[model samples]
Target: MSITLTQLRAFLAVVHSGSVTAAADELIVTQSSVSAAVSGLARELGTPLLERDGRGVRPTPAGAAFAPFATDVIGLLEQGRRAAVESAENASRTLRIAAVTTSAESFVPRLMQAFATAHPGVGLTLDVGNRDRVMGLVLAHQADVAFAGRPPRDARLEARALHPNEHVLITAPDDELAARAEVAPHELAARTWLLREPGSGTRSVNEDFLAATGLAPRTLTVGSNGAIRQAARARLGVSFVSRDAVADDLATGLLAAIAVTSAPAPRAWHVLCSGVGPVRPVVATFLDFITARGG
Candidate 1:
């Protein structure tokens, strides 16, 4: 007889639990049934997978090596079962998403909540990172979809504009720099400016703004939005961030926007996908939800 997935699962349970009784309890079968399954599996593979040592069970060297493979097989099989059930209930269920840090915080969570409400059976995974890391997730097929300020120029990806992102300079409410409605890029050139890391999309936009005004500050790189926001709150300097990210701070008077005359207009936020193929249904659903909400 062919080895069944059930037999593989039983063997894995026994190996993981390290006792036939425990494995039986986990599998909801009798200890004898679990032992029979393990023995059958061992015979099918033509190897001794386990042995009794004193009053406990231990895996043989071959079983120890095979245990991981069995675990993986059972895991994939269980995932398949779950997917099949979900498909029967709602064929659109799936997982795989990537987003730049700012959007991940400001927009992605709401989008996910909406999607979850619409498709309760769906499995979801959201990858959050900087611009380059998010793009890398998409290209590597680690994520089926991604959200970012702008798509990379790489020919192997497809990007569609989802919304407009306005950049603003933010400072603590009590900060000396908060009084001005606007500050020239050169005015703070000598100051210590908090910024996202070099490869961040925000940093890139900030660089363009500085370049346009022929000013570059002494930048202190902090890799995350939260870190940069805290730095700005501590009056470490000032930072240019997405208007959406600082909305709460703006509303509560914790931070103030610095108007810059030559600041660029709002840029487009794009949803990026690998050019490798058509978008998955879950990814499409998320994109549709975000775009519909004006992102």
Candidate 2:
């Protein structure tokens, strides 16, 4: 017996939705079915695909490496079907978008929806990951457009400013420094700092801030932005993150921003695309819409 589409779907569902129960709900199947499919696939592959994480679930390193390939396989099959149907109609078109984690959680959805609403004939699919994965998609010509804080300097990619974005150092609402006028770099040296995994733009920003200030604190690498947020909420450590990603939490006093010297310089969110060749019509159309309407 070999791996099946059923197993792939079940695995991806749990990866995306973060739990077997959630995956079952998303796939409209019983939790046992989702669990069995994932376990069976892992057994067939001779590896564990998931690990329990503090009452939830997380992809094992092997599973994390496998996810993008699995996503592409499903996406390509869907794309082929759409291409066949759209060729007959001669009216429908598909657009693929990729965005880094922060933008994907924030304004990118609204931008996508506005474009989709304005152009009802276009089919939109989005892939969200860290900066490295998103840029990989753009450089490989797998995605029509991408959004990120910045791309590594690459001659083949063109990036235009979408808007100014800011990162803030956040802690639980009752942190000791929240009442201070300002914090010094040395004051933070004794505290623990939360870092995103490598290849993440947030980690890049955190590194830049630390470098500029010459402060090295105890650092713990949490894998994702959501985990960092939860860590901050639990007072596990301080984290640097997009304001947009935690605006509501800040406003509601669930998280507090602490002011510090020479930290968190403002950066711009950019719309990115390949500069090496002609962009597809659907790609051009989306760029025009956002350029005119403001993403």
Candidate 3:
């Protein structure tokens, strides 16, 4: 009998997730079923693929060598299946998206909700990460579309402007900076600042503002836009973020937008995809829907 896609998936899931229980949970199968599939696959290959590691499992040397092949086979099959489904019944295709944290928190979910309402038969998946991770998803073909606050620097990506992403210097409502109609760059030079991790799009913009103003304030790095918002609201430090991310907080008087000299130029929301090929129909549909929404 030929090796089945199910067997490959079971093996790869275990290898990637580092445990059979986690793989079973992800696959929605019982641990015994996952073990059986891996065992069956090993029998078909006439070699051992995995072995017990303490209470869990680890891929054998042979399994490590075979892992990439299994992944590629599964990826190719998924691509072929998506192509067939799109050609036969376009409404059933899945649209996969990856977006940076700011876009994800501020607009991407609502956009996906609206898209789902308009295209009820289409399956959708949205993954959120930092700018680098989102760009990596697009480059790896793991996501059909990518959204960010800035255009991707990768030549392999084709980017389209979506909407203006207005960034503001935000502080707690009670902070001294909050009382200013406009805070000058020099005024910001010595304050403590809260910002996103180094590779995030927001941090890139924040760094540009810092460079333009020649300010190197003491800074703390947080992993998500939500965290930064919370930190700013707590008066931990000021942060620069897309206005969309803090609109509710701004309106509620929880956070104040501080005007700053030599602020980063207004950046636009961007949609990106692989530059070299035609996208799936569902992806095209999502792209059209988002572009029509004015970001």
Question: How well does each candidate superpose onto the true structure, as a TM-score?
Answer: 0.67, 0.70, 0.73
> Which window of 10 residues has the lowest lDDT sum in candidate 2?
75-84
Pairs with backbone N, CA or C atoms under 3 Å apart (clashes), candidate 2: none
User: Whole-model lDDT for model 1 versus the true structure?
Assistant: 0.79
**lDDT tens digits, residue span 1-295, model 3:** 6899889999989997889999999999999999999999999988999988888788999998788667656765666677886778443678888989888888888888999899898888989899888986776568889888777566668898988889989888888777777778898777788878878888888888887777889999988888888888888888789998899999999888888867777878899987645566677778888889886
Choose the strongest candidate by TM-score.
3
lDDT of 2: 0.86
Count residue pairs with overlapping backbones in model 3: 0
Model 2, TM vs. native: 0.70
lDDT scores of the candidates, listed in order: 0.79, 0.86, 0.84
Off by over 4 Å in 2: 1-91
Q: Which has the better TM-score: candidate 2, or candidate 3?
A: 3
Q: Mind sharing the TM-score for model 3?
A: 0.73
The candidates, ranked best first by lDDT, are: 2, 3, 1
- Superpose all Cα atoms of candidate 1 onto the true structure and report the RMSD in Å to 1 decimal: 10.6
